[model samples]
Target: MWSTKQLADLAGTTTKAIRYYHRAQLLDEPERGHNGYKQYRAQHLLQLLRIRRLTELGLSPASAASALENDNSSELYEALTAAERELTAAIDKFNAMREDVRGALAGRSFGDLALQLSDKPPGLSEKDFAVLLVMSRLFDAETVLTFQEILHSSPRTPVDEAFDALSPNADRKEREAVAEMLAEQTRTRTPENPPYSTRGQGLAEAVEIMEKSIAHLYNDAQIEAIRRSWELLRAQKTASDT
Candidate 1:
């Protein structure tokens, strides 16, 4: 028979741990003797040693206790299997977060011109980055990759700068001129009309979200100019096809 302190020291744990185990119903408390000191038996020492061994094996305190309580070997195996699955899921989540951080550090670039005209283009504002973030959620990785390539090969001209500088309150004549210029540029730059791929739905959704974001970031006149430019470009394409 040994005292609580002696059992704790022999088991390589503290007295506080023994008391916690008692409260957790993991350890059986010994009865008080005539001198008012609790007497711990060999069984108590063995249980404490078992708990320390289980903890060394990476079993949580609760799992260790529950595994010890199971008399059947199969039940213990089940508990350990569940712990393994939880660890794997945690590892996967961490890996995904690490990849996202690496991407941020690498610089997802855009330009002052249209998104299609810049892979690592300069003059991207914080608002433009915000739109890309939204777009990233709506589109898949492949579509965005292709879009970036298209932008990288695009030619930069003075007209692109004019559209970028266009004010929200631009007059009708100014809007029309910008839109017509943009349409002509689109026609000259992208002469080949490839069939839109099925993957385009994701890009379309992302573009819609980006347009909404642009509405909040740019003034009404700028937004109108952009809308009119796309419309005129589509009409020009239709006319050429006929």
Candidate 2:
């Protein structure tokens, strides 16, 4: 027989832990002595050791109690299996995080674009990065990878700079010229058959997000130029098909 402190010391834990075990009903409450102090027995010490062992194995207090009550129970097996899977997943996640950190230290960008792209396109603006970040979440990974490849491989031109610098109140003539240039560029660069899927169950939501992003990220003239360029491309495709 010993005091609570002695039992805790023997179990390589703290008095606070012993009290917590009592509240959790994991350790049996011993009888009080003449001085009204609890007297712990060897049985209590063994029980504390067992509970600590189960908890160290990643079992919750309740699960540890359940495990103790029935050592060969299926519930204990399931708990152990779940703990193992969680630990394995956590290890993998941490390893990936470490690799990302290493890459960043070596001057590589990581995050929304990094997973799909080796590096961002030259002269990619903050607004473009924000749009790509949103797009990464909206589209599937493969689609994003394809988009990144296209952006990386396509060279920027004076027309791109003109479109970017277009004012919100730019005249229709300027917008149409920019649109025609863009449509021509798109025809030369874009594939006749796109390598990525644009149709899916989430297509409607994806389109809504893209429309909102475009409206928020670009001015009126830029948006008009984009819209006109798309229309021109469609018209050209229609004529070719016919």
Candidate 3:
């Protein structure tokens, strides 16, 4: 039998911790001497060594003490392996997304333009962007990836230039030219999943907000040009519906 201090020295822990372990019922109560000091024997040393071993293997103190009985050591090993696999998958996906962002910056031009155009407040409202973000959530990963590819197309004409250019004082002819060009461009590359698709035929509120934000960007004559082109677009849609 060894004294508490001797046991603490041998086990690399404090006598107080040994006492606490006994209180926790993890270490069995040792025998007491004539003077009433507790004496720990070989059994206590072996149990503590086992506790340290299991602690090194990621088990809690209680689990470490009782691991032989609970069958959790193998389970912990498998859980660690599963977690590693998930982390690897996440890392690979992040790397792939980074490559796409790099490619879209130059190779996939329109996609980059959309991001640039969206940099200003009310230029491409966060609410509108939020609607686009929601569609990505609703679609499958492949569909969302395809939609991203569609955004990379270059602007087809001078109106695309005006729409993207950030000048508030663009003339009526310039704005109208852009409106006509955008209408033709939009007709050519109509999205299979439009932001307004979820709203179906009832897109008045969404269109109003978008149009209002855009209207505030240009002068009175520019507004008339834009309004006429938009009316032409509405007429085309109405004729198509019939």
Candidate 4:
């Protein structure tokens, strides 16, 4: 016979837990002696040990009754298998997260441009990204990559750089120099409908989306440079017509 504290110590659980099990009917109540002191017996120890074993096997207290009555060995086995599967999944997730953390530490730029376009690349605005997604669908992956490179290079004049590097405040001399260099550069890279041009419904949407997107990022001088660049193509086409 043992007191509640003694029984708790022997069972390696708390007295409160033992009392809870008593309320749960998992542990039978001990009988009170004439001195009004209740004492726990070996039966109590056996019951608590069984409860702990079942719980360690992942059986819920509510389901313990079901476990006791039926041939739940198959259920217990299934539960253990399910627990193993969950553990495996958790490990896989941890490994992936660990790899990501390592990449971040190394600054390897693991993010995908096509998928995570709206994020990481701070140069592009939200509107710019939406249009780019359309471009991915419309253009070949190679073409899209080429365009990304082009955007990074982003033809700029010596004058534009000098002014930007010096001060944002515009000057006529610098502006003219910028315009000349831009015209020269744009003349070289103006869009020519190639054999592999992305055409049809998607093409129109892509073009429209792209135009609408960058409408604000470029200034009037930049826009003029682009128009001047297109003039060469227009002139050639006009000559052919004549």
> Which candidate has the top score in lDDT?
2
Superposed model 3: Cα runs more than 4 Å off: 1-149, 154-158, 191-195, 199-201, 212-230
lDDT of 1: 0.59
Alpha carbon lDDT of residue 74, candidate 4?
66
Candidate 4 positional error at 44, Å: 1.2
Q: What does candidate 3's lDDT look like per residue over 1-242, in tens digits?
A: 56788666545578888778778777788889999998765556556644543343334666555544455646544533443344445655545434433343334533322322222223333333333333322343344335444444443356655666724576666767767776676656655334333223244544444344334345555555556665767777888889
User: For model 4, how does the per-residue alpha-carbon lDDT over 91-195 read when each residue is reduced to its tens digit?
Assistant: 555454444334433444323223221232446444334334445445655555555555545655564464344333556555555555654554455445322
Which structure is stronger by lDDT: 1 or 3? 1
* Residue pairs in candidate 1 whose N, alpha carbon or C atoms collide under 3 angstroms: 116-151
lDDT of 1 by residue, 108-173 (tens): 422211232223245544444434433433455444444445445676688888888888778999
CA lDDT of 155 in candidate 3?
A: 34
Q: Is candidate 1 or candidate 2 better by TM-score?
A: 2
Can you give the TM-score per candidate against the true fold?
Answer: 0.41, 0.46, 0.33, 0.33
Which scores greater on TM-score, model 2 or model 3? Answer: 2
lDDT per residue (tens digit) for residues 72-142 in model 2: 64675576566555554566554554443344334443333243322345665555544554455466555
Which one wins on TM-score? Answer: 2
